[model samples]
Target: MSTALLVIDMLNRYEHDDAGALAESVGESVPNIRRLLDAARQQDSTVVYVNDNHGEWTADRRELADWALQGSRPDLVEPILPSPDVPLLVKARHSAFYATQLDYFLRTHNVDRIVLTGQVTEQCILYSALDAYVRHFDVAVPSDAVAHIHKDLSDAALAMMERNMRARVCLTDELVGVFGSR
Candidate 1:
């Protein structure tokens, strides 16, 4: 399957109101996300960093990384920072496809399936999965790779995606095998 791994909102500086809480929650998921990234690289799957631009329209990947490194938890951004060759799409909204070239980019690369990973599982992950489903791209969300601000909402969101969007609500190891298979 032609697949892409979308890493969302992990480049955050944690400067918002719920930044600390969100950071702490997402911290546990970082290692899982890193595992997914490493597997994606080994499998030759497309790795895209779809980050929230943090309202800095002029900011590029380097600028965003620099800003994030100065935040309370620089370690959060260190492990998962996109390499220079990896495509980084700066999004202004929650859904990565909203007003962004993500759809076209995926199509251009012939990506029919997407593995979603990153922070705020109830927000960006949920919305992005909906958008991906409506756009006809198969969605796979590893439960352990996504961080959430709210437990109840996160569980509800995952259920909604699995039941409604038909997303594969599996674990990171399972997804790694799938991505690595022919």
Candidate 2:
């Protein structure tokens, strides 16, 4: 099955109330995300980034990246910035599929499965997995590639994704093979 790597909400500003805790987790996640990003690109797999516009209605991908870089964590943003050629859909909500062209884009590209990576393990990742499941898209979320605001909630969310959504909640290393041989 054709698969796409969805980098969700990684272009973050860290200006929110949970930013400190989230940033701590994000520090660990960013490297794994970078590794996956590189692998996906090398294997010629489709890679798309769905990032929050941070309420900037006028923001495009570059603008969002610029804004994120200017925020408290340029170290996090610089490594995983989407390539110019990569399709980036700006999301205003938690679910990447919500009010966005992500579902249609994936359908057009014949992407039946999606590997999710990035910030807020309990929030965006959880919501996106559910939406993907309901839409009949196979979902995989690498544990180490996702950051969480709360450890307990993140753990619970992962469990829900696996038991409820049937998502593959594995490690980053295990998911690298997915980028190869389709």
Candidate 3:
């Protein structure tokens, strides 16, 4: 089965109310995410980025990344920036698949399984996992690669993903093993 890595909502301005806490978690997860990106690319796994548009409807991937670079925590976003060649989908809501073309994109690419990584684990990551599950795609989420604003909620969310959604919740290295390496 072909696997695609979905990097969700990592591009942020950090101007929201709980930005500091979220940024802290994202800081810790960035290295793992970077490693996942490198490993996925090296292994020939498809890599796609799904981000919040921030209402910049006209902004392309480069423009979105550039705008995010101007945020307070550009350091966190820099290491995991989506490459120009990677497909970037902008979402308006918490779930990446909600009102987005992600499902169609994955279908077109023949991606039967997906590795989800990025911010707000309790929110976007969890919702995306459910959406993916309902779409009949096997979902895998690397715990170390997802950032969350609230630890307790994220823990519960992860549990739900594994239990209800049947997602594989593992560490970055373990997920890389599942993906296989060159």
Model 3 clash count equals: 0
Please list the residue runs of candidate 3 whose C-alpha ends up more than 4 Å from where it truly belongs after superposition: 180-182
List, residue by residue over 1-182, the lDDT tens digit for candidate 2: 88899999988889899999999999999999999999899889999999988889999888898899999989988999999999999899999999999999999988999999997889999999999999999999999999999999999999999999999999999988787645
1 against 3, candidate with superior TM-score: 1
Candidate whose lDDT is highest: 2
Across 25-141, the per-residue lDDT of candidate 1 in tens digits comes to 888899999998998899888999999988899999899999888888888989999999999999989998998999999999888999999978999999999999999999999
lDDT of 2 at 65: 88
Q: Judging by TM-score against the true structure, name the best candidate.
A: 2
The regions of model 1 sitting more than 4 angstroms off are: none
Indicate the residue-level lDDT of 27 in model 3. Answer: 89
Task: Note the residue pairs that clash in candidate 1.
Answer: none
Candidate 3: residue 177 Cα off by (Å)? 3.1
2 or 3: which has the higher lDDT?
Answer: 2
Determine which window of 10 residues in candidate 2 has minimal summed lDDT: 173-182
Q: What's the TM-score of every candidate structure?
A: 0.97, 0.98, 0.96
